[model samples]
Target: MKVRELREHAKELDFTPQEQVRWLAPRQLARTAVKAVLAAVFAGYSDKREVQEVLDADLLEAPCGQPDAREIWIDYVADVGDGFDATSSVAWTLAEEELLVPRAIEGTDASPAVGDLRLRRGSLLVLGGDEVYPAASATAYEDRMKGPYRAALPKAADPPLMVALPGNHDWYDGLTAFLRMFTQQRPIGGWQTRQTRSYFCVRLPERWWLVGLDSQLGSYFDDPQLRYFEKHLSANLEPGDGVIVCSAEPTWLESVETNADAFNALHWFDRNMIRTRAVPGSKRRVPTHASVRLWLTGDHHHYARYAERLPGDPPGTGVPAPDSRRRQMVTSGMGGAYLAATHRLPAVLPLPPPGSRLREKDPPVAFARMGRTYPDAEESRRLARGIAVPWSGRWLPWRNLGFAKLAAGLHAGLFLLLCFLFALAEGVLRPVDAVRRAGLDDFWGFGAVCLGVAAALFVLGFLGRLLRRILRRLRRRRGAAPPSGPEVATARTALPPSGPAVATLSQALVALAALAITVAIPFPPSWDGWLVLLLCLALAAFLGAFVGSGVFALWVLSAKGGQVAEWQMSGQSIEDHKGFLRLRIAPGGDLTLYPLVLKTICRDWELRDEPSGGKRPVPTGKPAVRLIEDPVVISRGA
Candidate 1:
């Protein structure tokens, strides 16, 4: 396509259902957004004096003075670190606003990101996991995620309540980071601070009652979430009332047997057939009504829809076995992640086809119990809600070509590999055209052997690294000997107590390696040059695998503080924020602090005191911030 055509196409992908932006004056709104973002990005809101000063300083006063939206986005992009919810709130705002429109045009020659559009109009913006793609850190959130969402927000909005569900990605640094921002849902019991980031019902200006659930809360004893399910399932059984259930992982992708174990039931075979309303002393409080329609989910890296009849509530005998009915399950993880392929319809079953024909279910009960009718709207942790299924259910289906889908990251995967290999030839294996060079042939042989050895070492190194890491963590939990390494006592100076120093080192290594490979390739292609180029590329990859493994190690060690579990009024509505077993620990003897400050900047922990400067006892009130379950492992170095 022509360049203009390409730009036009790019604009098309950023498209959202256009509606008049309310609140802000049109032109003034754009200017305000740009300036506010720029101020928020580089400087923060802590110093209201400066924030307001910056906010008020008219960019138009100076020549080319007003900050452009793209510049604002770029500036906001710089401040993320291991700050959790604060960064999340910002990213959420950016994503919902569809603010990234200008950058989509400026940056590239490809289709815009789909999630770039704001939360659907009149639809409650439900976060179905890893609302923030990486750890809820400032660095990860702002740098890795903020840019893209900002680049996409011109067509979106924060849209009031974004019912967020936690995914492993949200908890990549641990559940606390995920919890810090989303106070409406608390981590369920036994699941640790791994709370049910789920909620029930939202009243948007639109008539629809938007009900949300945190699929991850399914891991507790006495599943209050389940009871809430029965309660709400019974109370809110309105006709055509839609439940836009958000989960990092989708229900249909779940395994029946595994789900049965999580919910402590026989099996949950129906796709999206969540067992909601249960009755007094019943077998299980499975919802019988089918009118609760529409399910939306994420985790997979594509936008897909399944318009078909789902299996009925497994435990409920009241409903006639659904012979066939209309239902749909969708995957909208396409917002941006590792993009994957749209699976072709005639997909062959990886598992054996069921041997026996399926049995039909009985009809649903006519009436649900009273409390059972309403979902527990409280942000309670007793609900055993979770997005727990094996890794296969959560991620197996999607491909991992970052934003490449918008820019050939998907289809171009192999071709990029070929280009990389070709670069190797240009650097290390050239002069084959002058085929008769005998000595060069012998040199080529030596290089190949070395390359092979490097490749093998790379694989072995990664494996050993992974095994050792696993063992080290296992030991930590067992309270055994520490991992074999000189503790970087000075890590505090180099690595903040919030995120990974080791992972940073690894990334630096890979970036340095890619740069080295590029440098190694002596442009016009000579035999020795090609040989060196090839060797460098191989070495880069070999080394990169190890560096990446180091990142994974830090990832495994990550933990953060949780969101407030319970809230109460301080008489005339000046509510005071309270407890959440909030703790921070540094594994390298220095500490990484992923602070759980409520609804603010995703930042490093600033000092905040525990309720009584005392040790943790069973908190009388729900903890607004909980302890980090894992630390973002870092390597302190000289």
Candidate 2:
């Protein structure tokens, strides 16, 4: 049976704690983490693509849409489904804006013949990946992903086409729910779904193609997926054809620290499937090649574009090349997830990092980032301090209630552990008087706990210092510039060498202060004493949310590492800097990309009752949306 239409009788969705997926919540964190592990283990045993192949349900030859349509507009977004405020805000913006005309199309050449460019609502909506947060399920898709979209555009006669690529979160259930929602050729709200497989190829007008690849969890592609692409390209693709490859992850950006499985796979696909024509049963290529013009992805949760190094241009210059059709790697994952730090984006990205498979014919090319980032580097560094520094501007304890609770729980657990250790040391065995007696004897038990925590902090600080040193040496060896940005601005001060040392000392002091608060509670056997313990626990929880989070931030700053920098901002639950891509493929086969970004999501939503048993969200405060930069245009040159 077809899934019932959500728009007809849609119920109002509460965007509060009940509906939103708090990523760091204890239960949610444990469940998703365990499911991720199980999914990985079971993935090799059961491949969904292979199952489709066995059942002969593959959509390789499925009619995607009309291939001869001259002009088209597409809305592409990824990494969605966190909070309703963010998700619904994005959906509302897309739905409300019937036509988007940029304030000024400034980058192109000034010509009277060039008419004003108008971007209408995309007939095709491409959801790049991670449609829901934490995990994928029927309820998750309905509540977190599909429902918001339906409410945004409740009904439409000429509905837009929707296609999706599953990100890591979507694979937690082995893609069971993903296949059900996306591959069924059913209508989701006013949008129509036509893709018959997780991965698909859609030919556009003027010899341009949109290829969505499913690199399942950034691992190897199934044989069927690879063969499907290879066979399709060999049959339909011709020399000089332009291809826009959409993937779930931006492996090139991640290839720096992560294992090269995904990047290597993409490189192989680019070399064999798209770039070169292969001889039968041979690892050779013909001289004729299709132009793999743009690699569009969304794993990083930010907007960044990297263009191939031109012949005479210097590195790290954010200037657009004269030839717009050159290979450009763009990451636009800012659909509706927590904002990621943009300060750590490398000025220049080398295509194949060391240890990854090198390109067979061409040497490793340095791809320079073409323009400004979404939050911009300075703003990202500034935003990070609120999380890294205690009591900073953005460091309100209530920002992430889930993390605050988790922190409190941890501190409470620690208190219990200390009580157990104290009881073990003493001759007391009865559980009835354990807490009352633990602190009655002496301060030794509490003192020991403080010492242990301080010792751990010192150790962590030492390791961070060591890691920083290793990184500095590596940068010197590679002749790369040292890490800059506001977070590291303290290092350039007069006390440069003492930066990490001071940070370590401060962290130890904060830990002692947090522990001392709990130690101050007297252990009288009266009911009043238990009440005092409860008060002390509350204080401890506050300290955990405040100073505990700061300790982690200090460690990240001291380490001065990109991976740690990313972690520092992970739990913030920031609902700003959200973005998506609006792409226009003209009749002449020119691709114009508008990278639109919204600075802050609308928070106050008014719930209005709908006739279809659904509630619609109307924001009192309009979102501040703007283009990230001038539109990126890729022309089909003669």
Candidate 3:
């Protein structure tokens, strides 16, 4: 972490309990809600498809020719922010200073800095998704993206080729800024990028192809984009060509409850683009590539890798069997954003089975041994243990006695306030029954009964939390999986799933029920009885809204720190930190992955030795570097 970010974090930690609850929590919630509303409204008004020109465009050509050694260095990062937050900005700067730069001149006697692993000249820089945050406006792009990159990565004499894909955040303004920055033929520093569309295909040496798709706001590909892929695959792609696919977000991770159709977009892309093959003995044309070798995605704000394990395969073979080679799914979304939790994920994720012809190897040891940790893990543990409450500006659900006591106190206070107001109104109205039946003599008793009712209601509210905990414990004891921690208590207290109309009808029925019970209390059929029933209905509505709002607040707090949409697809977490993948494509089409930690000040990179199959020899010495302005190559159907 940078010094400034550390200072900012320290300031946040210095907030008092009262200040956090009274000010910070409300401020953060309001800001987040406003941004969400604006983004949603803008997306609704924007075009829902890729631009026609982009869809019809050809693959972007690099300024330099294929390397003589057939080796390429690619730096892949996703969800990178310019400096949205102090911590994220510092992390992004450090990544550019350390991992994005080339090593200093040799034999200069300059000391090596911590976490210094540089990229070579003429390498390819691929931004997986979400280049900016808050909004995708031109000003935001300039402040958060262009300015930072220009400072950290100065114009090199021979710059690498740059390419990027649009994420949901980038589409907030309908890709206006993203298109201008990436699609327009331009050079950042010495690196040149020529992209005419949001999605593109790049042909590397050794018949390896990189295909990036634009899965925009709706998680669906546009018709033109789909057709472009179909045409490209049918013409240039060969059946045995090694392929790597880049998707904007890991739609495969969206849960059934949220997405309804698990892996819908991914399945479509795989079936239509990557898995399609030519029809034998037919005149109709079709895609030639049978499958892709790797699928890369982001938008979950964490890093995870899952590979199919074939029967009788070697324990650490990272290489996929030819038939199932395209089964590897890697998520590297932790480029720069608030870290997401990795615990409480579903045990078995829904995914397509490996093809019969494909061979699987053992999963990577790093994935097997990855631990779950996040920014709020400690707070969650404390909350679960009753050591803390929900007043830290960290909005995790309150699970213990402290939360119950706090909630009960709040309800009791509100109930007392409402009763006082009702009594004041009754005293002014001077109802005849009050004077006829024992007059003011029973005033103390009536007040006592009302107070008792409030006390009982407060106690009942606390019992709901207790019941939920008991149920969770029972489920665990029976070896049955429990719901997510944040959802467990709320789901128990929440109304059953219903449409808006049904929900309104249910509320009306509840009010009528309260009124009926009040009228049945042996009171005479007079104006007094009707007034009492009306009062009962009013009290019920007040209490209902109060309890409902409290529950909603708790739900909001729980959501603030839990897992994101991508957690469902994380087969296993490698570690609980932000990072991206550094891919090295060898001349023989073999691939090696180096997971680099983005937030670390020292020892930022991890090179796993497991999944040992398809391991390529690491390069030893530097090669002669040169800059060439190659012409754009447009392949057309003959």
lDDT values for all models: 0.30, 0.69, 0.48
Candidate 1 residue lDDT tens string, 432-496 = 22221223334345346445655576666667767987987897888844212211111112222
Candidate 3 lDDT over 1-638, as tens digits, reads 33233334322322111110111123333654575566567764665454554434776433346444476766677876623232233333333423343233222345544543454433677788888764587766665566445433445555677888988778767788888888876875445676678888877665667888887665567787877776665356666677778988765444322342435666666665665644546755466545566768877665555454445555542433333332456677766554444443332232421111111322111112122222234532333222122353333223222333433344434433433443453563423233223223344455455556655755665577678878879878889443343211121222322223333333333333332333234455465645653554455555444443334333333332223222112211112245556666666666655554533312121111224221111112212211111111111110
- Best-to-worst TM-score order: 2, 3, 1
Which ten residues in a row are the worst by lDDT in model 3?
Answer: 625-634
Give TM per candidate.
0.34, 0.80, 0.57
User: Against the correct fold, how does model 3 do in TM-score?
Assistant: 0.57
The candidate that wins on TM-score is 2
What are the per-residue Cα lDDT tens digits for candidate 2 across 1-638? 01122233333443222244545556766898899999898987877878775433333321135555788888999998877678877887777546444454223343423444456778778899999987899888887888778768877767787889999899889999999999888888788887778887776667777889887777788888877876776456677788888999888766644443337877878777877666778887674457678889987878888877776775444665646756788999888888877776766665665445564445666677776677778877877776655556445344556666666677666655554554565566632244455453355555666567767876787788789999889878888454343222121232244455555555445544544545444555566745766765677667766676566456655445544455456656677778888888887789888888888887766667778765666677768666777788886542
Supply every candidate's count of residue pairs whose N, Cα or C atoms clash at under 3 angstroms: 101, 2, 6
Task: Arrange candidates by lDDT, descending.
Answer: 2, 3, 1
lDDT of 1: 0.30
Model 2, C-alpha of 460: deviation from truth (Å)? 12
| lDDT of model 3 at position 378 | 51
Q: Which of candidates 1 and 3 is the stronger one according to TM-score? A: 3
Q: Model 1: what TM-score?
A: 0.34
